[model samples]
Target chain A: MQSNQELEGFRVELRDWLEANCPAEMRGGEASESSICWGGKNFEFASDAQRDWMERAASKGYTVPTWPVEYGGAGLNRAQEKIFKEEMDRIGARSPLDSFGIWMLGPALLHFGSHEQKLHYLPPIARGEIRWCQGYSEPGAGSDLASVQTKGEDKGDHWLVNGQKIWTSYADKADWIFALIRTDREAPKHKGISFLLINMEDAGVETRPIKLISGASVFCETFFTDVKVPKHQIVGTENRGWDVAKYLLTHEREMISGGGQGLSGGRALGAVLNESLGEGQEMETTLRADAMRCEVDALATGLTLERYKDQAEAGTGAGDASAMLKYMGTELNKQRHELLMAAGGSDALEWDGPLGNRPADWLRTKANSIEGGTSEVMLSIVSRRVLGLGA
Target chain B: MANLVMTEDETMLADAARGFLDKSAPVKAFRDLRDAGKTHDAKMWKEMADMGWAGVLVPESAGGSDMGHAAAGVLAHEMGKTLVVSPFLSTAVIAATALRNVSDARAEKALAAIATGDVTYALAVDETSKFNPEATSMVATREGNGFRLSGKKTFVVDGALADRLLVLAKTDDGLTLFDIPADRAGITRNAQNMIDARDSARIDFDNVEATGEDVLGQVDSAMSVLKPAIEAGQAALAAEMAGLSAGAFGMTVAYLKERKQFGTVIGNFQALQHRAAHLWCEIEVTASAIVNAGRLLDEDPDNAIMAVSLAKARATSTAQLAVQEGVQMHGGIGMTDAYDIGFYMKRARVGAEWLGDYGYHANQVAKHRGF
Candidate 1:
């Protein structure tokens, strides 16, 4: 660990570096979902600035700064990583790349995957060369993920996988998937599962985009029919995939909780309200109060995240408290969007044009609680695992 | 005052305060104090003063240990858990904030006296007005070099026992703050019986005399100091409310585990478990808000208002829900006066109303947002 003075110096240098490197266009307001870069085989650049930003960030390993430098990361410690984030936040730098592989699969591979797997898989993720999607929730298993029946039959050197995964976010665009598959049908529900890595382009693999109310198809139903996955593609042991699944779920929840801080890096609610209400808008006192309260809660949620990160760095990792964070974060996100919608008034109801996007984004926040885990499921975990309140 | 992490010193301070309160002034002690017809435990107040809690916000140069509002918040939180009936919030938090915000020789003298447990102070801001601080209608007329104050201040926490009163009054310029001795001539105090049985009074000022030395900060521009000082107080109250809610929630959970019904403990029921889980989440979120408010007070005084209001509003709502559910979950026992859970509900009610209710604070947040 470096001294505080050394870290301070690093921060100054890092701030200057980011300012010099990050394109001016990428340092403005929040980046819309469509503008986000999910590096994959078929990824398209939204703009030159976006492509340039991703290339610059990936070259320096800032996309996955905490990972080992050998795995295309900056290899910064947790404290330095935090400083890096703060500096980026100070300049409102848009995330150069958004990938599940970075948030979920990358961490799992680092912690539980073999050295061979880490070397093979993590660098591509760090470089944003391959985007990944999760294959956790099956049609049969939503909250009861242990009951997943996505089966993978053992065959000498490969596994034949078959089953459908519901709510697979961005599956259509993903290059690969880290999925939970039942390798042993006779074993107990949780014991027979295996975490498998399969290319989305593999034979008999298909994704059907699920159109949402917001008129977006970000979610897809991913199906695997006799899909061949090499034995080495199996993460962890065949019958012990539930462990990897559980670990990955923690990361997934953490990722969803990041939405609590606003996925778009949108302007502050107060700022938005000020613009919408204008100088003489007759905004109701109750509405204003609700907006302010929600804004405060959102800021507090950010602070809470920092506290949990600090605690995690200090060795008291959030553990099941990640459920608490996920629950609070998603709920706060919903509250923020709700207030935004209210501030927009009749204009928020438009279904097209720039003004209509607020309503769409507000509707999008609805998925926050449902995805990762339903708010109810998160609450149950918090009560039983975090608060020790169980029946 | 949102802190992502507490320093080792702060953690130790919080832990020690909690331990002391648990041992010395638990929920049962509140009952004992009431049975003894005492609004506050003077001995405990002195003990807290000895612990340097009274001077937590006072700078070291003013004959006190200079701790940040975050530390004071920790102490306030611990005190709330045990419902430690004292003037600590009024005297230590509000008054100390006023003295610190406006650093004058007279204020420093008062700070010194407060540090040694020799004197106590309360902000007599609320009149027959609404919750707004700017609604103060007390008149302060200039009389030669001095001033004559006359009006009524209602719902002044610990006002009856305070040595000095930070009175908000209307001057020729605008709203002002006057620090006057509580025992000054022509001043009368009457206890107002509250649901929580906490020390509060309605003070009547009948042409009370004050000089230039009595003015805190500027005459009409006291908002510069009073705004942040009152915000600090609000943040402290939010911390206390968070503690009270957590304490109540814990007690309710314990009761659910112990008190069995229909062949097993009722805690086994999914319905109660779900409600308990919801309460736990709410309380945890509110805790985050309180920490944020305290951090803003210590670090970003200029931007502390919104965070303070958020903390107060969230904690107020959370504690209210917890206290109400606490009584309901405990069945018939929770409703009885003999039970400690009932006390939490009463204390939560008073605490919620004292600083500002959820609606009031939330409104302030909205107003700050330019509504």
Candidate 2:
């Protein structure tokens, strides 16, 4: 563990910086996907306060605090990055920016992209100047993602890109798409793919929204019809995009797994129960027990996540142990939302219910087990890879 | 303050304990003792005390190492891994916690003797079945300057074998805890053959006389001392159960790798593999809860109720999963009496019911969570 004595001075400075710079409107901000600041050409902030907060955070390199200072970051270590987040959370200040560029593409670029590519791509992501979307999942390749049919023929100068990508989150608002293209059709499914960075402004690119059961259009069906992409824009070695994709998938999985970092903000199950059931009113014993069980399991999951991080900090990486975190964390998240709806009762069914986003949030959690990597796939990975139970 | 991951010192201590337990006492040793109709071995107890295990929570002034609760938890966790049946929890953890709270000369003497491997203590708390110390009806009526104790304490683990007993009794003021000899007049210990093959008994205290020196802390303040004692025992018990889960999981995984059916290992089958993986995740998560509980107990004892309850409840459920899956995955061999896995199943059952069952701790969690 990092010594507190070393972090004491850093923490005080961070706390003061957050308190002074973060606007009152941004503190305890709206916890909704619609209010998120996903910076793009057409991106408009929900309020002036939101815009100012993002600019201030970007200037201080708090958006991607661990990135190198040359790439618009604070150059903080993992320990300092943790302190930065904690100080921000202490003031109830919401994250200044959220996008696929900062989370998924930036890590892939940092690892697999060339030094020039990192210089060109990473700064914009860290500054939230451009929003990005992942173009990996297809109707044909959900769990078997390696069998991607998006062909990218070897056109000497600039390759031709064509195919469809499903579940491209915020595709309409995104300025670019990080996609996988088939460069060698004759090669094996996993061997032929190549990671491509394509601008959404390219003529053939189109995005159509797909409404979810929660009555939200957070995802889109993105089509790449003979779109032109410079050969130099490819990440990593060509026809080896599977390596980059897998590396990026781990980040995507951890982020969505919600191990102590779920989208559910603030209020706990018991507090929700008391709010709806009334403070003095006696609740159903079984429901109450269910709420308590959820709380206990959530506590266990959070500690497990922290332990793994500590293990990583101690130079013993989480390794195969991380495979199971996605399974446990996502399952627990789904369980929490299911109990949340149960606590909300008949009132939860109302469109504009007193339980703000409780109904929509409940439906959204259903996707948690399906998106990123399904819970079943995570279990299989744990069993076959970690446990060595494969035939 | 809550460091779920062990420090360098704690890791070394665990490594040492693992080496000692594997050599001196393993699963085979527990099986042998069960076959011999014995709950514990006195020579083994002496060796443990000689190694300063009995003094893990005891003070240096009383000739103990006084390694604190985290070190004691480390020892208990290693003991549980090998199914080492002893009075480590009852004597070193529970009784020592109660005795150390009182500054009397006799209490100090008892602790010093405990450090020397000359004394073992058991807690007598339960009345009928459930662990509700607040409802303890064991009367401690004033008789002149002394008190007459009359009550029956059931599920008294190590009661029949311990050198002394810590009894929770109701007094005119409210509830009082007494530290007295088990062989005292009017105290009868009827040994009950438990499923775990451990030394548990129903002790009857019929007008047992006790002086002022026998009382721990003061009259009507049993909760003051007993609360911390029980919480300590509960956290240590949680660690033991977590260790037990890992032990059972290790055995099951080994069996999975070796046992074959249909021209391949059964572990290769997706059905069993997923179940094993799920169990592993449960064990890992529950281990964090156990570690956090010990941390909170050592660093922040006053507000450790929620953490302790969460740890106990999570450990109890996780142990159930581990043993149940351990047997199911082991198939027919797991059910046979000749196998060691059955012993783990029985021991897990005992741990579940010892301090508090799933429902009991769940309620505690709900209460603190304000539901």
Candidate 3:
């Protein structure tokens, strides 16, 4: 860990830089899902400020702060990056850009990608030129992800992809996808897999949006029929995609475990509850108690997350314990929403009122446990990996 | 305010404590103590004192190490792994905290005595309500400059063996704390055998005399002393509970691997594995909670009470579930006294209910949060 004096000095420099560069519109206190910028081909900026924010932050390599500078990152150490985030949060600055490319693909490429692959793929991702969506789960492979049936025939120079992926968040809008494709059909379920990156604009590729209960079309079912992917697009070894998939899943779980941090965009949860419940009115004791416990647990989880981050910075990634964080983090998020719903009462059900947004946000948390990996699967991993239980 | 990682000395202390307990007094030691109708091993208590645990919280000026609450918690956690029945919780933790926080010279003398393993103390705070310290209504009437305590204190842990009793009492001004010899006149102790095979007592304090110098802290401001003492006790208890649950969880996992059923070891079953995994996750969270409490107690004592409650609450419930699953997963043999799993279940129940149960601590957490 850096000395407090060094961190404080860095904070001053970072604060000055952000103040001079961050656009006024981009400093909006909280970001709605629709307001988030996901850059790609045909991507709408929403506002010039949005575009400028992404450009400036990316130019400074703030998009992926902790990654090496060679890969279009600020090359900040964990402590420095944390301090930078704290400064950003202090100003309630909205995230300059949000993309699966940054959260999922960038990490996988850095760890498992070839030097050439990192140079080719990571810079564009850091610059937000391409948006990415995951294709790990097919209709038949929700929880059992390695049992993917998406076959990628081994062509001499390229792979022929033929498969369908379900619950691909933002796949309809994404520029490309990193998918788990079976390269060797005769091998075991896990061994024959390959992680292939394919563009969404390829011929025979199509995506149909899946409407959620919240009436959002954020998710899509994607189909790839003989969409040719270059052999160079493969992430690790030809048939060792499971390893890459697993590694990416760790990052994905870490991202989801961070759901609590993003949900309100740095707004105080109590402020939201107060808006619905009416300030100064006494909340039911039981509900208040439940909220208190949830908040404390959230604080504890936040500390746990920091510990894991520090552990990762120390060169030992959280590994399977990420499952524990994912499990607890999602549950904490659901509980936060549950309390919000309870606080809103009948007003929370209003379709277009101030409290109306609580319902949809609460519903979105339902996927926190199910997506990435189900809570049950997470527990199974915790038991098997962390506890060394079972055969 | 939470220190996630332990200090190097703290980690060394924990390692040494665990290593010593593993060799000197494992679960088999607990078995022998129970079978022999003894709540604690005198030889092991002396060893712990020699290892400087008894005076862990006391200041170095008073012939003690003053390692702070977090280090003491490390040893407490280790002791918890073996279910080592000792006066560490009542005497070293609770009584020593009270002695360390006061200005009285007699308190320093008691601290030196505790350091030398010549004296042990049990805190008498609970009445009929079981674990609530604020429920104390025992009277201590003033006589000249001193006071005379008269009341009944039930559930005084290790009270039967304590050389002195640190009593929480009501005064004309407010609540106060006093430390008096267990052999003092008009103090009658009825020893009770607890379910966990620990020694507890119901004491009737009939006009027990106390000097002005015997007061643990300023009169009517005993909450200051009592609160930290209990917080220290709860932090240690939480760590112990974490240790107990971790131990039980480990034992159950081992049993699942060795105990065969139908055609294969039961551990091969996904159903059992998932349940065990859930328990393991619960234990991890509980362990973190305990660490947070210990760290907060040392780093930020002003707001440490809430973290203490959080730790005790989570550890209480987690240990309960761990012991329950330990027994259920072990089948019929777990129910028998011949197997060690049953002992853990019994010990967990006692530890969970002690100091404060889950509901009590959760309620405190809510109160502290202004809910």
Q: So what's the TM-score on candidate 1?
A: 0.93
Candidate 1, residue A28: Cα displacement in angstroms equals 4.2
Clashes by residue pair, model 3: none
Among the numbered candidates, top DockQ falls to 2
Question: Residue by residue across A108-172, what tens digits does model 2's lDDT show?
Answer: 88888888999999888878888899999998999888988988877788989888999988898
Task: Please give the ranking of all candidate structures by DockQ, highest first, separated by commas.
Answer: 2, 1, 3
Highest-lDDT candidate: 2
> Per-residue CA lDDT of candidate 3, range A1-391, in tens?
6798997899999999999988878874434466678888858998989899999999999988888999999999877977887788778787887788888899899889999999988888889898899998888898988889989987899999998999999998898899999999999998999999998899989999999987788899999998999889999998999999888888888888876653222555554455667767877778766776676566557667776776676666789999988898898888988888899888778655676456777788788999999999998898778867665
Candidate 1, pairs of clashing residues: A391-B268, B1-B292, B1-B293, B1-B294, B1-B295, B1-B296, B2-B292, B2-B295, B2-B296
The clash number for model 1 is 9
Model 3 chain B: lowest-lDDT 10 consecutive positions = B1-10
Ranking by lDDT: 2, 3, 1
Give the DockQ (C-alpha) for candidate 1.
0.48
**RMSD, each candidate, Å?**
2.8, 2.6, 3.2
TM-score of each: 0.93, 0.93, 0.91
For candidate 1, the share of real interface contacts preserved is 0.56
List native contact recovery per candidate, as a fraction of 1. 0.56, 0.76, 0.42
Residues B1-371 of candidate 2 have per-residue lDDT tens digits of 35467898889999998999999899889889988999879999889899899888889999998988888888888888889988899999998888888888888988898887889999999998888888888899998888999979999999989989999998888999998989999999999899999999999988899997788998889988899999999999998998899899999999999999999988888888889999988988988888888888888888988788888999999998899999988999999999888888999999999988988898887677566
Stretches of candidate 2 off by over 4 Å are A1-6, A16-35, A75-93, A114-116, A259-266, A278-281
Q: Regarding TM-score, does 1 or 2 come out ahead?
A: 2
